[model samples]
Target: MKERVLDLVFLIGVLFKGLDGLLELVGGAVLLFVTPGQVQRAAERVTARELAEDPHDLVANLVVHGAAHLHGRSVWFVAAYLLLHGLVKLAIVVALLVGTRRIYPWAMAALGAFLAFQLYELIVRPSVAVAVLTVLDAVIIWLTWREWRRGRELRTTWRQTVAWVFRRPQPREA
Candidate 1:
């Protein structure tokens, strides 16, 4: 009976992980759609900065030279920022999924940790959307690391089978 209960708990945990993965997939898709343009502009601005530039000075310059001119362009600016943010997040999720074959158990534990963090954020300290997304990204990273350690063997076998099926025959070496 205890073993059966434990099995149920394990199954529930797996289901929860699946749900978390799905959420990440959705979030990633949304981010991809929302985060490219703004990122480009931000990247451009950062690239323009010389070494050892003070952050406050940079902000002041941006507000004066960039934001000041953008009173009429605020909506576009915001849209670009959102899109770029989402795209970066999407990229992270993709990377996590890619590594899953090598790290399943670790992935499961990390997903649990992520859920715990989200509970804390929602119940104890509500943050802005950006901060929440950042937390979610951290959780995904943790999950990926966990999966890497636990899923390596399963991944190896799967990979070997795939190679066997698709591998081209080579001529005998002289």
Candidate 2:
């Protein structure tokens, strides 16, 4: 029962990862076509009301500030990064969903690499959101490792049982 619950949690985590990947995929594609000026305009349009209401809204101000300083090169870099990251994540999630044993270790390794990169980013420039994401990614990787081992053991035991059941009978000497 505990294992079942853990499995459920793992599934939920994977689902969230897939959803996040989907969002990144869409955002990256959209960013490729949108100009920095357009992004700033949209940010101003969206945050105008909120900023006016609060006059000191942190989130709204941050969005406006970030959008204001966007450069064409920076935008392109970010878009490309997001596209690659999202595509890799989506592929891993699909393999995991389809129960591809061969990809489990590879997926975990890829995620671990991403986590290591995130850790380096944190060291260079810390952000609470990034920290949280890094932690979550670590947890997911650990869960995947555990589940893969469990599945491997189960498969080995199952194969042994099947072989024993199907073994040819020994010849009896009269």
| Model 2, global lDDT | 0.81
TM-scores, in order shown? 0.29, 0.78
Clashes by residue pair, model 2:
none
RMSD of each candidate relative to the true structure: 16.5, 10.3
Give a tens-digit lDDT track for model 2, residues 137-163.
998998788878876532443345455
- Summed backbone clashes in each candidate are 18, 0
| Candidate that scores best on TM-score | 2
Which number leads on lDDT? Answer: 2
